[model samples]
Target: MSDAYNSSWFAEKLTDRSIRGIALETSALIRAGALPVGAKLPPIRDLAFSLGVSPATISEAWSELRRQKIITGRGRNGTWVSGDSFVAKPERLASVGHYGAGVLDLTMAVPDRALLPALGNALVHAVSTEKLNSYERSRILPELEADVRRTWPYEAEAFLATNGGYNAVYTLIHALVPPGAAVAIEEPTGMRLLDILEDHGARIVPVVCDSDGPLPASLRQAMLSKPVAFIFQPRLHSVTGQTVATRRMAELAEELRDTDVLIIEDDGLADISDAPRQSLGRVFPDRVIHILSYSKTLGPDLRLAVLSSTRLIIEQIQSYRSFSSGWTSRILQGAAAWLLRDETTAEGLKEARRLYQARRDNLVRALAERDVIVPSGGGLCAWVPVASEPFALVTLAARGIAVHPGKKFAVQPTHHLRVATSNLTDRYEEVANAIALAASGG
Candidate 1:
């Protein structure tokens, strides 16, 4: 070890011995220039011995630092002060490569702007919402709750409105999951989901998925780790676009029956997916938390999503939220409620679903004609198997097209690309040819 890894000096600088304390003190030291970037940290055992604390404490503190990107390296390589900053980058989201001008970007799994329902009338109706501008935080508008309840998969004990689907997931996880706790989520899930889990330092246990949805056997094996929660897209998976069949839902519920783990069902596609919404919430009402997002069906600007669970869990998430925004924008919630209840919006949603499915089908059929078979699941994107992620990415870029690498959405290695088909309104054959070529690493 170099003189920079002076255990005695480092130990003296750490007055607080608790995990949080050690992490904070170390961060302060690095920011204050006491520990310069590139300086190697003392080994866990040596630092713990010097500070009169357990090695576990030192290890956890280091883990927190690593999560914040303040330190780098692990195991035999030795830990080093990588940076003086304190921001935790969402690794997966950041890794989704950027595209330049003229590149046909098919990376983001988002709804086509042209298909989104008009929000003008909804916003106009929102002006009449009761207690419109009150400072008092309301968990959700009464009208909104009633509208959501009419379609809720179960008789939820309570409901809480949030900024959007991702916000609801992030808030709930932050409120319930402690650092390093295991969380089982569907494999090849939305990249944003993985980002949230990693940002909170949760040990992500991937539940592998098949065509019907998450495989029960994989979920059972993941449960062996005793994860705090099991999250999945029930209606339509945002990544693979596969819907969890009713039978699969029952099997998943059965696999989780013995455990008290929280069940989080994210219905991200909302009305855009034709599949009937399914939830394990009906089976385990007290433990299940269901989130329904209208971003795709209505408009992303609505910034509204609703979550339902037992009053206790809802209250916990609301309390955590109080520390920040306190409450979601009522205007957005009211607009969403208006849109949900409007007949015109209903028709628009039906049309949007038809159009998106058509786009997805067109891409699938086009690919099939070129000897590339991809699942025609319902969603804004399609997962296409590839010979190599890197080679496929390079091949697509060479053809002025861009797509997300499958590795961005999975914990395990995957050779695939997530191509956005929502806006693939025309030239399907042309784009499909490029994709098929990329898939074959040509």
Candidate 2:
């Protein structure tokens, strides 16, 4: 845009910043009128050279600005500030378009039902010829708990079975996280997780991540606010399918080394994930809470997951649950355990994992062919970086494609939107073309 940088305050604020910090300060400059809305930012190389920082830093700063709606990319026309402090973008659900038959929805993360085996068979096998009367039994049945525990990377003194992972999250947030406290979460997290956290009266502090998962610097920055817990999806991370590298997980564990911060690993996709499940729980077993949900793997109707945690948290959950729904039904527990050992179900799950991986991988390749930022793999969804969230949302929606706006999941400003790839098994090119157009300032 401009070779002659007008803002003297810009370079001054560039000191002591991770790329994200630099972006935040540039936003401050725009809000203060140093770089007024509609004014073009200085050329990336020029600003980076002027500030003695990398051009990548300037690029990331510009990206983060666009994400916040503080700036807009006008293709070859160049980038310009687009909004002011008082004119922040609204967070409203856009009305869905009715494209009827050809419409493809990439919003929800659910699997293709046709790929899974018959849950009726599993349930029938579980309930058939069994004594159905149980007046007194542990909230978590002993046999089911033991079976689920065998899959965990680490051992727990006691296990708690919840209706599902989200239920377990609610239990944890209510019982563990003190009200009015703040918790750390991955930026661009699930919208429902945000709701649960807010419902339980917890403030959110986001940690920015790359494909390998949350950056160590971002984690360090997030912890600076002293959040009460770190709730992150370690594997098959929804919307991105980003499984944290073992080395990166080790780094994260080291960061929480001496802290009291509770770490919750949301292993949502469970056995459906192509990657071998890895957890930071092994690093700090006493301080970690691991939840593995099977709804995506078996059948959503099962509503079951294994919650592995320390005795203290387990007891707290039980005590809190005593006055509520009591416990997960023993029948559902039996069904889940029975399904886990079912040969046909196991083969179907294996195939489902392959199909999800293929779709996700193909979508990533398709998007990348068009030069869209495709940070994905090992999950049912993909995260595509865009210059503007609203522009992408509207542009894609108008093309008979539906997807969640990236801003809906952002705790801080970010420039990416999630696309559920599983349903696009046969429409990769079509969806990718639409995304490329939208991301190109449609």
Candidate 3:
């Protein structure tokens, strides 16, 4: 690491974007022993000066590298090459798909595509009106801002429209958590988040849940001992469709107020709910990081989500977004905004609520018919208490169905399973048959 290397060669290489340019230059540098493992990158200011790009652009490039797990930032400690084996990209899916082989996908919480309102025609019309140029130019376009206000009205300044609910989690985690920290999550949550936390070098601390929600006692205990970030899918909680009761939300906030913790509210399947509960941020606005997407309400392919927090967090995230792509997709945001404004979409959501309610009713009936007990909630999943997790999982898999075992959700077992009710089709008999067989120890 010489001054010349810092000022010239590194500057030229960092500014280049071609795949070949990147691969060739990086490979050449590595082979020539220029870039090595455990090497420290120059500060964004110095690097930006050398590359002749804005510091924001250099920071975005660094974020791209960080997302790839190519580099690790230690905040004041500066950035260094990562020592972790598995690298995670922003759009990468959890490796949970391998379990899907030979198994019916009763495990996924995917919404029915027919339920999403058809607003593509309006989107196309809006895109032509918006006159987009490139990724950088369209991020903060007027229509996208209007869309954000229309869909989710708040006093936030910046918005980063991501691919899907899961991508929303990925981007936010990358922005909030530094490498080698701990993130607190509910015991027995969606496993994808656990993978994301681990992939980003944040250890997962399981905060126990009582009848109301995350146990205040357990959260306080965890906070007292170590630095941990809180992650929860507040509305339409995945795996288990459990909504944190609004009254309990106030209590949870009180428990967290004295501590310095980051709260990530993963409202992934939020659109499915009708009644408004006080958001955790409303309780502790400065400490909360809220994320939501249309994956559960709109189609899975619709790939749009929103992130919001206090003004400081919003600006910090904007700093990251500014360097990366600068704004949300203008075309997509315009379409989504139009959809948000559409009465038809609202009607479709009403119909979807009815249909999903019916599906839940059907599952409840099926469970009652077979003597299997399930908890009541407004989301698309059910938390079923069972005798054995492994036995239930293997039995269901053998019967051509896939259900997430409770142990997957917990750092330790409580002998419960989360069965997603959203995937049920018209085959009520088939689902009933599978539940009965699993219950009878098949």
Q: Pick the candidate with the highest TM-score.
A: 1
lDDT by residue (tens digit), candidate 1, 139-171: 999999999999888889999999999999999
lDDT of 1: 0.90
Clashing pairs in 3: 60-323, 139-327, 184-229, 188-409
Q: Which 10-residue window of candidate 1 scores lowest in summed lDDT?
A: 1-10
For each candidate, how many residue pairs have backbone atoms clashing (under 3 Å)? 0, 0, 4
lDDT of 3 by residue, 1-442 (tens): 3333454567665547443344345445644566776677677677667666676766655655665566688567887766434334423234344654656676666677777677667577656756665645443446655665554523444555666667767677787787667777888787777767767767677888755678888877777656557887666677666677777787788888888888888787766876563467656667776777876765665567777676677666666666566666666666766767778888999889877767877886788778886766666777777777777777877778777766666666567766767767667678766766676654
Off by over 4 Å in 1: none
Model 2: residues with Cα > 4 Å off, grouped in runs: 1-102, 128-137
Q: Give the lDDT ranking, best first.
A: 1, 2, 3
**lDDT of the candidates, in the order given:** 0.90, 0.78, 0.68
Writing each residue's lDDT as its tens digit, candidate 2 over 1-442 gives 3444444445765674567787777777777876677787766676777777788877866766665677888446777878876343223322323456866878877878898678686677567424444644355766677677777777666688899988889887888888658899987687778877765557789888877888889999889889999989888787567788888898898788978899999988888776777777777878788889988987788888888878887888878877777678777888888877778888898889888889888988988899986755667787788888899989987898888777777767767777887766697898899999988865
**TM-score result, candidate 2:** 0.75
